[model samples]
Target chain A: MTKTRRPNRAEVEPIRVATVMDVPGVIALDEEVTGLLKPAYWRDMFERYGARPGGSRVFLVAESDGRIDGFIIGEVRAWEFGSSPSGWVFAVQVRSRLRVQGLGSRLFEAVCESFRAAGVDRIRTMVAPDNTEIHSFFRSQGMMAGPFIELEMRLD
Target chain B: MRLQKATEIALYAVLELAIDPERQLTAVEIAERYGISTHHLAKVLRDLGRGGLVDSVRGVGGGYRFAGDAKRLTLMDVISLFEDVSADTDELPPQEAGQEIARGLRFVLTELDTQSVATLRSITISTMLKLIVRRPWATIALEPRRPTVRRGR
Candidate 1:
C-alpha cells in the first residue's frame, strides 16, 4: 500500500497583499463567518485600503488552492485623542473550519510587518466586549487595554 | 463577580445625576426610587462625594449633583471605589483533580475578569446614559420623578 502525505500549511497556503480579484473570495470568507453578505462593504474597503497609493494602509489575505482563507485590514492613524501615530487594525476574519491552524496569526503578522514598515511603533484595535474569540486572539498577540476610552451617543 | 449593594447604589446615584448634570437628587429621593435603604444610600453618596464624583448642594432644592467629567469618568472609576475589580487567580488552591485542572480554570477565570474590567473601563457615564435612553422600555424619561412608594422621613 502507498501512503499519501498531506501538504503542510506553508506549502499550500500563501499570505500576500490582496489584489482586486481577491475581493470576492474575501467577501465569501467574511460572509461565512459573520453569516451576513456584505459585498459592497468589502469592495469599498478594497478600494480604500487595498488599492490606495500609499503603503500606510494594508489589506492582506491568506490563500490556499486559490481560495482566500483569511484576511486582515489596518491603517496608520494619529492624534485622534492626543496620542502619537500608531497602526489601527479594524477588521480581521478567518474561515471557521480552517481556524486553529495559525492562518489568522499569519495574516495578523503580515499586516504587522506592513505597519512596522510604515514607521509605526504601536498597534491598536477595538473589539466588542462579548466577542471572546477575537479578544482572545488579540490578547494572545500581546495586546492589552489601551489609554483611550470609547464612548457613544444616539441621535434618535 | 456580583457587585456589592453599595456599588449598585453608587452607580444608580451617579447615573441619576450624570444624565442631567444640572439636576440635583437627594439620597432619600434616589433610595425611594430604587426601593433601597436611605441610610445605606446616604453612606454611598458620602463616598461618592469624597471621591470628588459628586458635589453636595446647600439651601432650598439642595441635593447631590455630578461633579466629575461625564466624558472622561468611566464606569470602572466608580466601580473601583466600591469593588475590587482585580483578578486574583493566584489565590486559588489546587483542586482534587490536580494542579493542571486548577491552573486551567484559573486561567479562564482570569481572562473573564480582565475582560469585565476592560468593558467597564471602556464605557463612560455619557455613553451609559445614551444606552439607557435608547432602550425601548425606558419611557420614564430622564427627569427625576417621585416613585409610587412613599416613605416618610
Candidate 2:
C-alpha cells in the first residue's frame, strides 16, 4: 500500500501558457466574462484567429485546483507592435471567489512574453476612464491609457 | 459584444488555471466548474491552445497545463496569446447589435495593449479584485437601479 501525495498550495504554482482550451473556465471568470457577453462570440474568435498563424495573437490561461480561475484576453496587430505590429491586451478578468490572489498579473505577463517571443514590440488595453483598479498599474508601468471612456448604460 | 465575450472568456479561463496550480484541467472539467456548456467551453479552450496559452495532453492521466509561471505573466501577454481568437475588428460577420457594441469596446482592447506591463506590475491581484468587486446596490452612489434578488448558488 502506497500513499499518493498532492502538492501543497505553496508547492503548487500557477501555470501560464501561450494557450489552453478551457472555455468554460474563462467564461466563468467573472462578470467581466460570464456576464459581459455570450459564449458564441468566444467560439468565433478562436476559430477565426487562434487557428491562424503569424497573426501575432496569443491566448494565455492560469489554472489552479484543476479549475480555470483567471485569465487575460488580448491580441496583436502588426500596426501596434512597432512600425510593423505588436500585441495588445483586450480584456482582463478573474473569478470573484479567487480575488486578492496574483492570478491577473500572471495572465498579464504571460501575454506580454508571448508577444516578445513573436517579435512583437508593443501592447495595449482599453480601460474605463474611471477604472482605478489598474490605473496605478498603467501609470507605474509607464504605459499610456489613452484618454477615453466607453459611453455605456444598460439598455433598460 | 464578440470582442467583450472573447476577453471575458479568456480572463476567466486563465483565472481558473491560476487558482488550481497543481491540477491539470480538461476543457470539460473547466466548463463544468463554470456551469456552462462543455461544447462551448471546448471551443474556447481550443482557441487558447492554438494561441499558445496552453498545451493539450493526450492520455488518461493527461490534461492542460500552464506553459509558464503565472505571477510573472501579464494581462497584455495573455491577451496577445489569445489574440487570435479576438484579433480583427474588420473580419467579424456583420451583426448590427454586435457591431455597435464592438465599435465602442474596441477602445478597451486598444487601451489594454498600450498600457505598460509595468503598469500591471505595480497592481496586485488584490487591487484588481477590489475594483471589479462592484456592489452597485451596496456601494453605488448614482441613482440606483432596481435590484434583482439572486438566490445563492
Candidate 3:
C-alpha cells in the first residue's frame, strides 16, 4: 500500500504570461482580494488587453497544477499628469494562503521586465494611501512616490 | 447609536456563515442558533444575497453560502447590506439663525458617523471572528481595575 502526498507550495509551478482563458480564474481571484465583483470590467480587460500578446499591457499569472494562484495587470501610460510615459500596474494579488512566498514580488518583477521591453524605465502603481502593507511592499520593491498626488471628492 | 433589528440579524448571519465557509447553512439554521425568527431572517438573508455577500441554492439540501472570501469582506460591507449609511444633505434643516445650534449638532453627529464607518471599513470579517473566539479574560487579567480610595472628609 502506498500513500500519495500533495506537493509543497514552494515546489509548485512558476509564473507565466497569462492568456485569455485565465480570465475567469483571474476575475475570481481579484474578487477574492477585492470584495467587489466586476465581471464586465474583467471581461473587457481580457478582450482588450490580455487576449493577445505584445501590446502596451502586461498580464501575468502564477499557476500551479493548472490553477492560477496569483495574477498581475499593468500597462504603459503617458501624458496623464503631464509627464513622460511609464509603466503603471493596475492590480496585483496573490491567494491569501500563498502570500509571503515572494509570489507578489515575482509577478511584479515579471511585469517590470515587460515594461523594460516596451522602452519604459520607470514603473508605478497606485495603492490606497492608508494601506500600509501595500505601501511597504511597494517600497521594498524600490518604488517611491512620484511628483503627482491623488485628489478626490466624495460626490454622494 | 442602535443598530436596527435587521442589521443585527444580518451581522450574525454573516458571522455564522463566515465561521465555517465550507459548510452551507440555511436561514432557519442560522436564526435558530441566534434564537431569532426564521421568517425575518429569510428577508435579511435575501438582502445579503442581493448585496453579493452570500449565494443561495434552491431545493433539497439548499441553503445560503458565503459568496466570496470571508477575509475580503469588511464589517462595513456586511452592515451596509441592512443599513443605509448613504450621506444626504437633506437631513440638514434650513440654514437659519433659529437652527444654528441644530446644524452644529448635526455636523458633529455626521463627523462621528464618518469616523466610525472608516473604522468599520478597516476591520474585516475574519478579524472580527478571530476576536470573538479569543480568551476575553486574558486582557482583563493583565489590566486589573485600580481600586479607588475615598478621601476622609
Considering every candidate listed, which one attains the maximal TM-score?
1
Task: List RMSD in Å for every model shown.
Answer: 21.6, 21.3, 14.2
Residue B115 CA error for candidate 1 (Å)?
4.9
Quote the lDDT for B3 in model 1: 92
Per-residue alpha-carbon lDDT of model 3 for B1-153, expressed as tens digits? Answer: 567899999989988888887788988889889999999999999999998888898999989988856655777788877786643356645566668788777776876676455556655676567667774457557964656668988
Q: Candidate 2, which CAPRI tier?
A: incorrect
In terms of lDDT, the best-performing candidate is 1
Candidate 3 accuracy as lDDT: 0.77
Model 1 ranges with Cα > 4 A deviation? A1-12, B1-153
DockQ of each: 0.04, 0.06, 0.02
Give the range of the ten consecutive residues with the poorest summed lDDT in model 3 chain A. Answer: A132-141
Ranking 1 against 2 by TM-score, winner: 1
TM, chain A, every candidate: 0.89, 0.66, 0.83
lDDT of each: 0.82, 0.58, 0.77
Sort all candidates by lDDT, best to worst.
1, 3, 2
Q: Model 2 — TM-score against the truth?
A: 0.40
Residue lDDT tens for model 1, A57-93:
9998888677898889999888564578999999999
Model 1 lDDT per residue over B11-76, tens place:
999998998899998888898999999999999999999999999998889999999988668788
